[model samples]
Target chain A: MFPRPLPEEKPLQRGLYVGFVALILILWLLPLFAVMLTASKTADEIMAGQYWTWPKHFNLIENFQAVFAQTNMWGYFINSLIITLPSVLLVLVFSTLTGYVLARYNFKGNALVFALFVGGNFLPAQIMMIPVRDLMVSVGLYDTYLALIIFHVAFQTGFATLFMRNFIAALPDELFQAARAEGASPWQTLRHVVIPLMRPALAALAILTFTFVWNDYFWAIVLTQSDAVKPVTAGLNNLRGEWTSAWNIVAAATLFVAVPPVTMFFLMQKHFIAGLTMGAVKG
Target chain B: MSELWKRHRNWLAPLLFIAPGALLFGTIIIASSFESVWISFFDWDGVGPKTWAGLANYRELFADPQFYVSLKNNVIWLVMFMAAPPLGLALALLVNQQVAGMRFLKSLFFIPLVLATVTVGVVFGWVYDPNYGLLALIFNLFGATAPALLADEHAVTFAVVVAALWPQIAFCMVLFLAGLNNLSPDIIGAGRVDGARGWNMLWHVVLPQLRQVGFIALAVTVVGALRSFDMIAVMTSGGPFGSSEVLAYQMYEQSIFSYRFGYGAAIATVLFAIMIVFITWYLRMMVRLEKETR
Candidate 1:
């Protein structure tokens, strides 16, 4: 609107603008389009150097099947779910509680506590990598799904707390004051008032956390080893090593690993964008 | 118990609510950060007994050429990644229309941000393949040869960074889109009455209003650049002979594969030290924003 909308009578100009945007979108997604093309091609076509062409022999299904048959892709998918869901749930619970308290309470060291969450969330994972891995190993949880779960919950809670606290703080103060005047306990207020109002924020947080925990590769590699516990991201990497020449199969596997998060994004675009820009744009 | 609960629940409840998250965050994130710094001064191979090697790891790191290479690549990432915000703003402006099907187009543009970086890396690795990649196909159309980007050490980091930028750009675009939506209509109307249009409107009236979102985008980009490990790991594994390695990947390689936990921790410390400057700036800005909102 700042640039001013084109006049409705100028149909040609609007058409041209849309066409130009379409062209840019095509260019922007060229890599992904190439992968999709590759995923549908037969290995023979790929070997014959027909990457960008329509496949002479379509083998999308076969390539997808090969990804599962050759590697632990299915097991890894399940492992990712196992690790990601519990982590997301725990992060939600912990952050909601932390967010509620930090938002509604007046206390000493409140700012410092909030700062820790914000600061810790921003630090590179590499800085804490060695010690976190060591801690997991010493606790005998290394190479287990719980290792990933615990670590994700602990780490993601930082960002989630920041998000949830901001959202909770923005709620109308009058509601809390009224509840307090009625002698409703803190837990009752949270359970009845805050919880009901927090649905949208929690939904956004869940989707964000799910994508993050599912797509995690660095911690998955650092914390776990066996195929039994590895997530799809790491499993897809292993498939890359195994099927080095099978670009079609590797591309198929890549899509498989990417499907859940992409689907979530499409299904909940509004919440996802709201959650993502919460920190950056103060939405 | 009920009377006691009713009397003390105000202070007690907040403390109880905060305990779990605080404890978990404190130990795993905060405590490990300190532990990483502590481990940097010792000699250990991840699984064995630790030995004190005062200043030895730091000494070796300073003498190491690979350290410089990694440091230089990090600078490259930081500099190259700065393009995301402006590019994102461009894309946001381009799509910020109230036309038919614009929603679908915007969502399509956001697809890259949701896809795993591992997936993006793999796809881009294929795209850069000298033999049968999209680049090769495009080159063939022009009767030119495509260079194997990942295979060329000089071009490897650039290629990887380009792939990473796809998602980073989308992220910044989302931020900018949100910012653009929140622009005050009155301000825009005033600017219009003043006869500000097109580039003049954007440069004067619009750009200043976007300063806060721009700062956030810049901070996020800096962090993304520094934390670039997944793409490097999946695509090159810090090769064509370790030329594409950034500090994050170098730290991982030293600790996990090379079994030099101490050396890795030292590298981690250096990276953390670099990040502390940005982290402090970001924290101050965010805290200030929080206070302003309050």
Candidate 2:
């Protein structure tokens, strides 16, 4: 009571923190602004290279048409959906079931299998790049969407399993024991008991896996070949071929293709993030 | 004993559980990852008969400074990568509210995380453009100069890391928001009633609750930092005399570009070993925490 609260403390410090946050946010958004502006700028303006400045003339429609014309950005977008959707579903379903098994069952190799998942999660993608690619080719799945999907589903399982298992294991063991006592078949127990209890976890897994597989690139590049099989991530690189100087087209293309996941994130950010950091502190 | 064993020998049940996931997991992830080690020993150009070079690649890597630079960058990334946790918490607190358009703001902040590495790389590559790029134009607007972030030896790696940090920070924010949202408000209200205000509330109550979330964020971020590849590949391609190289990038450079498959595998093994250390530590800590909770 001796010292009166400063009138500006709430506004100033919070303001300053918000300001600090805003400044960084702007920094975060700066490249996007460049991409947007450059995308709308005309070919002549781009050649002049006044990228950050306001467009003398906006031509977003035409520029996007050109981008689509050149890169088939939509085709790649569809390819991304094809690869991402199945992989994501596979991750959610498999990781959930596997996590349930590991969480409830104190079977042998429980620790070993869990450790295997951990180590698998940490292994660099590069080490597996050559062999994975060779395997894909040998198996005749090379240059196919299946190559990308299978690899994404398989590797992502390591992390996703860790996530789903830790989360499921945190649930009360009484539930599992109760389910077992009720004569719920293993499949029935998983479906009725484990899965129903895992709505949030399943939601979490879906959005996380969707974002990851949606944004995946290293494997996209390694596993698939040609524009026929390539996703939007790799297609953006293909956009850089000769029209590389066409910053407008590149920007337009980038912005166009970036819409799906960005929209998904904005829409389901809470669940998306919860899924991402589930194992961060603990695992 | 025989009856019990026979009763438990419903092999197909376990096999069904193990098949789809284990088959794909084993053949693709586990086995294929090690296959590189075997292939690395060969002088095969990916097309011809293999010729094994037991330790030749490892020697070359030991002598290569690029490998050292990449390793050093990895060390830098691992250390600095921890910034995600606190920074994320602070950011979540900043944006987690009932304000108008908070949802929009959260998504806006989250855009970087959603975009592919190719987009991030190319976008930053342009943003760091020395001539007429966005950053350069801003510098000129202020009547000063800007360095070529991608080309300048001093700033190249730093710039790339900053570019990488954009998505990474977004990632951290995601976790923190989740942590904050799930926090026990009853405990928070009790503390507030007990005059736990501001920093005390945050430190004594919030941070402790957030510890679980914090570890998850750190694990992902650390993995993100170490597992970086697509961005490096798309952005600078390990440019400015390889100042921006990291272990993953080096592994790719060695195995694919320079055709030093064996050396690349060794670098990967080293990276794997380092990651395993983090994994084990994380597991031990998590397991202990769970035990204590029980």
Candidate 3:
């Protein structure tokens, strides 16, 4: 609407705009298109310089199966799930409680505590990298799934709390007042009233947190070493090293690593966008 | 017992709610950050005992040639990444149209964002492959050879930055799209009545309203550019003798691969010091905005 509708434009100008959009979209997706095509091709076809050609033989199932069967891809995939799910749940619970208290209470140090959470969210991971690793090593949790899970839950709580607090703050105060008038306890009010209303926010945060922890390569590499505990992101890097010339297998594995997050994004596209653009847009 | 519970619940409830989050953030993020800074003053290989060597790591870092290269690459990333916001604005305007199939088109554009940066890096690395890459294929059509982008010292950083820009630009576009959706119809109607159309409308009316979104986009982009590590690590590993290293990756390499924990902490501290400037500005803006909302 701001650019003026294409219908209001001259026919030629409208055509040009459509064409330009199509061009950019094609250019933007070219690499991914290549990946998809390459993933379906055989190693012979790929090595024969038929990179752009449609695969003479479709090897999709075989290539993907090989990715799982011939490598540590399965272990990596399970590790990712093991790391991501608990982290998401933990972050949601912790941040939801923190957000609820911050939004509803006028306690001492409320603003300072809120600021600390928000500020901690912005610090570079490198700043905390050495000490966090040392702490994990000292606790004998290095190269384990728990290390990544714990770190993610802790770090993600900052952003999740910010999001949850803002969301809870925006809910009508009359709801709380009505609950209080009914002689309901604060815990009861939260469980019965706020929890139900927080469904959308929770969905958004869950998907975002899952995607974040799933795709975390830095912590995966830092904390976990062996294939036994390495998530897919870092595992994919290792696979790349192992399968240097086997681009098809690597491509298949990359798509496999990407599937969960991509599915979540599409399934919850609206909430995903809402979660990401929460503070960017003014009311 | 019930009377005591009622009396304490007011304070107790909030404290209980805040405690876990505060404890986690304090120990993991805050305490670790300070510990890292403290560790920067000592010489340690991370397994053995740490020896107090005040400022020795910093002095070495100041003289290290790789540190300068990483710093310069970081500057390049910052400058290159500035293109995201403007490009994102352009894409937002384009796709913000209510044309047929626009939703599908918009979703298609968002595909890269759903993938991991590691995925993006590996895919782009193949795309830039000189022997059998998409770039090579394109060059073949034109009777020219494709340069091995990730292999070249001069082009590796640019190559990695471009891959990182893919998702970053998409992110900015999403931000601008949200901003564009929330633009007031009344203001646009008024501008239309005043003969504001085309560049006149965009430059004076549209862009002015997009100031906050633009600011957020810029800040996010700056922070992202500064924090870039995954793409470089995946694509090049700062190869060709460390030509493409940024400070984050350099810090990781120094600490983890090279067993220089103290030196890595020094690099982390410097990166933190640089980031605190942006963090302060971002927080100030956020606090002001929060105040306005209240």
Candidate 4:
């Protein structure tokens, strides 16, 4: 194995690896620290410089109050939750079922269908953007939450299916066959057998999808205008405009938009990394 | 009733599961793409009556200088953005060296992806802020008045692309780390025994096995750059007289801002055509690679 790490080298490499990860992680989180610090700063102090100094007053409450009072902050948050929750649910259910079907069933054009979904997964949003937009408008779904949900679920389905198929395919077929022979119908098998087994992947997908749908800016901006349907990403844009001069309030609002996904990423960091890196390693 | 349910359940259950996602996908993605194409052939403002444009929209797109500028910027995006994968791979290879608190560093590097886009935009906006920003701060340190990277015609697109590339490169690095983790030690052992080492071993042995992951990394980066709508929408808003507009941002401006639904659709159609080439080829390659591995 090109020699296992020598006894002496083991601790050294371990130390080295940990140090490297720490440095890189800090660098990655630097902008976030800047954002957080700015959010807590008074506008006057921010303009006066010494941005590195700890805030004397931590005007976070006042700034947040002003942000909510002046901007579409709450509207954006509600919009994001409304749009993201249903779409996440839809992607999870459909993708898992589709994966289950293609994995369990030896049907016609199975490979072709799987390929379409996988291919669509990687298709640039640019390709789907125009057509999807036009279709939404023609169908009278534009400027509505449904328009946003439809696009998010449809597009994300591609990636979700890719993950699910291989996972389902890789499961020991003995389980599926034994259940089938024992009079377990496909529906029953899928529900009672496969669905329970798919919990880990489903958990990963749900969290990942939530972050994606919530962070999404392009579709949200295009499909909805009024705060009635605006998600946080677009709301931040509007917030930037209204709080144009109040850097602190704007920063606070941006932090609020950031917190949910950031919290999800931190809490689910391991699963996030694992899910993202799936299919990455090769023999 | 139970027997009937069981008998029909086979097709019906999957369909029931499939229907919601499929209906949504069909209506929004597939149906919408087609609608955009149809709309592109007409001359319809979003809220107004439609006029038949035939191929006129396409012709206008062909003749429009700004369209070419946008397309050219996309080309620049596509080509230069390819740098992310190799850079990420290089970084992964470098930092994968085990050391103290390497964990913290790895997570730290990924912080850009976790930050709010508005924050990244504003922070970088300050970083590139024409006056009294980080860029300006550097210029002051050097005793020069800095030209606004975002405002300068020649520098604007490159500046935005660099910002976009920040998170993407980190993403690429993670992919490579995942690839490296799964790299077979057995193969490396053989290479070492055969007197291969270091760069030669990496290039001849390690690199070849990493092809699939590499392809994937490249494809994702390209797809991201092509659909790049954020930094442009935020930092400069495609300003400095629209020198930095790529198709995605332009499509937004056209449809949403200008309310020229038909023209916007046309731009979208063109972007879609370009994307199809890359994504189809990526899939075809991945499938072929998968088959070869099998």
Candidate 5:
């Protein structure tokens, strides 16, 4: 209605709009399509200069298998899982509790504390890189899975708190009052009442946090040094160095690395969009 | 114990709940940021004893040609990335219609956003590969040759920025689409009655309503541009002799690769100083919104 719906448009204009949208979509997805095509082709086929054509040989399984068997791709994938799962869980626990407290309690320095988290979330990661690395080294966490997990949990808590606080705040206060009237302790009320109600928010945060931690490259490189603890993002960067001219293998590895987050996004599209666009829409 | 619990629970419960998050954020983010500023004044490798070097790193950084190159590239990224928000608004308007199969098309456009920045960088690296790349193929079709974008000092930063713009535009489009959904139908109806249509309707009526989302898009784009490290690291490694090095990548390269903890912290401090300006505005807006809701 804002731009005059296509139904009200002249036939010629509608057709042109459709054509234009379709063209833009193709251009937008062109690189992804090229990678997918390259991922399915043989090294020889890629070298044959028919990069855009249908593969002379469909080597999807072979290419993917080679990416795993030949490199530390599988190790990195497992490391990502190790790093992402506990990080999401820890961030959730911390943020949920923090959000609940910030939402329900009126206290001294509440606004200041909330402001700190909000501002900390937006600060460039570079600012903390040196000191955090030094801190990790001093604490003997550098190059360990724990290093990445701990840093991610702490850093993500800033954004997660902001999100969860706003979400919990929006819930009706009557629910809390009713629970209080029933002689429920605050912790009990949170466990039995708020937690159940917060499933959607928790799911949204989990999906978003999982994708974020999984795709993290900055801390991955800064904290971890070897394939023993490196996540897929850093591992793939390493693979790129080793497999420079092996375009087919690199393409296959890229897709393999992308699968988890892409699948998560597709499966949880609604929550993903909601989590990401939370502040943009309202504030 | 029971009496103590009963009496103090009112204040204690909230503090108990907030403790873990506050502690972690304080140590990792807040404390470390200040420490980084402190570290900038000392010369220390990861394993070495600290040596005081007040203003030496900053003075050297000011004279470093690489710092200037990084600063220039960052400006280029910031300027080029301004295209994303408007392009995103255009895409959002185009796909926001009730047209059939728009959902699938929208999801297709969302692909790059789902992929990791590293993956996106690698994919675009291939697409820009001079020998057998898509760009080369397109040029061959036109009876020309494609330049090796990542290999050229003058073009590498722009090439990487364009790849980054792909996902950034998608992010902005999603934000604008959400804004569009929240638009007041009454205002549009009123505008229609007043004979506003086409460009006038979009420019005057719809665009004004999208100011908040547009502001968010602009801020996020600015932050994303400044934080551009993974792409540069992946695509070119700030190569062609560090031509594509932005501040973030330069900082990382200096600390991790060049073994200059003090220098890296200096770069980080500079980047932080730039970010604090934006962060101050962003936090003020958030706090004001939080107050309004209360």
Candidate 6:
């Protein structure tokens, strides 16, 4: 209301304003629109330098077939699922425990532990790349799915713990007091009080972590080299190298790679934004 | 065992709950960070035995011209990325109204943040493609030729940064939208009663409440800029001629392709040193904010 909402009675002015904003939105998403357009075009049209025109052949299905046929995109997509789902699950499990302890327990070194989680989340990934790679290699987990899962779970726990800790801390303290009075143990309190209340937070965290782990390209290259273990982001980059001039096919592949996370975002926009703004707007 | 657990569950449960997360984070994130710093002093190919090279990597890093270029490009990323928060705030304000289908429109605007940076980079690379790109199409309409942005050494960093900024701006907009929603209705009502409207109302009344969210946006943007590597890799691969390399990508190039893990660790250490300054500032702010909320 700070900008003063338009009067509900002023249909003409409101319609014009909405129309103007819609126009700007189109301009903003023009890049994505162009990609979608390119994805529908035939390879022959792309080679003919017809980027913006309507696809005469509408070869989207053929391009989709080419994406699956010419590359291991489906396998990479499966690998991404194999890596991402477990990483997200582990992050949630670990961070819930960590967040609960930091939020409820009043033990020594609590602040330091909290600081470590918060600070570690902020550090650039390159700072730890070499040692992590070496550690994965030493453990014989290199070029495997577990390497990515373990590293992602470990790294993402830092941020997830911060988020979950803040959220759990903000819950009404009287609930804990009541639980304590009822002779409920910490586990009981967690199971009865925290987990049920954490469904929304968990949902948000799950979506955010899924998007992050799925989109990770750096560690994919550093820890895994085989096409068998590589995620779709890395696979998409590999396809970029293989199909340099086939923009239509590459564009189609790009859309394929983006489908999962974008679908999740649209499906869970509320939770996604809630999770994002939990840290940004509040703590 | 059951009897003992009943008695000591309070003290023991906290430890059990914290151990897995703490251990994993300590070993992988904290320990690896320190180990990389330690590795910077040794000469190793990441596969061979380490020879104590004490400051050799750093010395070479200081002398290497590509190191300077990378450092300079990092500065460019840092400076250029500062635009996200303001532009994001503008977008948030533009779309903050409660209207029909606004929710859908808002979600549409957030599409970029959900898309992979690799996807965004590839799309933007096509956008910058000179011959058959969207830019070329636009320029052709005006009878002007488009510049091949990703191939020009001077322009490649800017081009990649622009692509990276697409998602970053969406992120900041989400933050600001949340901040706007949480603004005090009472204060806005009071401001309206006082006849404050438009920019005057925003500057004097609303802007003060947005300071914390703005600070968070700024910190996130700075961190995002420093962490810029994936886009560079997908788009330019730190080219043309390493002109677009930031410290993160340069470290990857040195360690992975060149097999100079020691030198890469040194570069990582330098980047860590720079980030420590911001990290310290960010931690302090967060700690202070927590205290204020408490």
Question: Candidate 4 falls in which docking quality class?
Answer: acceptable
Off by over 4 Å in 6: none
Model 3 per-residue lDDT tens digits across residues B82-195: 999999989898888876667888988888888898999999988999988889999999999999888899998998999999999998999999989988899999999999
Worst 10 residues of 4 chain B by lDDT: B97-106
| Poorest lDDT segment (10 consecutive residues) of candidate 4 chain A | A1-10
Task: Please write out the lDDT profile of model 6 over residues B1-294, one tens digit for every residue.
Answer: 999998899999989999999999999999899899999999999898999999999999999999999999999999999999999999999999988888898889999999988999888988898988888989999999999999999988998888899999999999999999988899989999999988888899998888778888999999999999999999999999999999999999999999999999999999999988988899899778757756
| Lowest summed lDDT window (length 10), candidate 5 chain B | B285-294
How high is the lDDT of residue B185 in model 1? 91
Error of 2 at A159 (Å): 2.1
Docking class of 2: acceptable
For each candidate in the order shown, give its overall lDDT on alpha carbons. 0.92, 0.77, 0.90, 0.77, 0.89, 0.92
Error of 6 at B89 (Å): 0.4
lDDT of 3 by residue, A142-217 (tens): 9998899899999999999989998998899999999989988889988999999999999999999998888888
Interface RMSD computed for candidate 1 is what? 1.1
Give each prediction's DockQ, rounded to 2 decimals: 0.82, 0.45, 0.76, 0.49, 0.72, 0.80
Report the Cα lDDT for candidate 3: 0.90
Error of 4 at B205 (Å): 2.7
Q: What would the per-residue lDDT of candidate 1 be over residues B1-294, giving only the tens digit for each residue?
A: 989987898889889999999999999999998899999999999988999999999999999999999999999999999999999999999999888889999999999999988888888888888988888988989999999899999999999999999999999999999999988899999999999989999999999888888989998999999999999999999999999999999999999989999999999999989988988999888768757756
Tell me the fnat of candidate 2: 0.57
Give lDDT tens digits, candidate 1, residues A50-83: 7777888889999889878877899999999999
Best-performing candidate as measured by DockQ: 1
lDDT of each residue in B136-253, candidate 2, tens digit only: 8789889989777788876777777777887788778887777777777688888878988787878787888877777767777888888888877888788867888898998888
Q: What TM-score does each prediction get for chain A alone?
A: 0.97, 0.90, 0.94, 0.89, 0.93, 0.98
Interface RMSD of 3: 1.3
Task: Report how far off residue A217 is in candidate 1 (Å).
Answer: 0.6
Q: Give the CA lDDT, 0 to 100, for residue A190 in model 1.
A: 94
Every candidate's fraction of true contacts kept comes to: 0.82, 0.57, 0.76, 0.53, 0.78, 0.82
lDDT of 3 at A98: 96
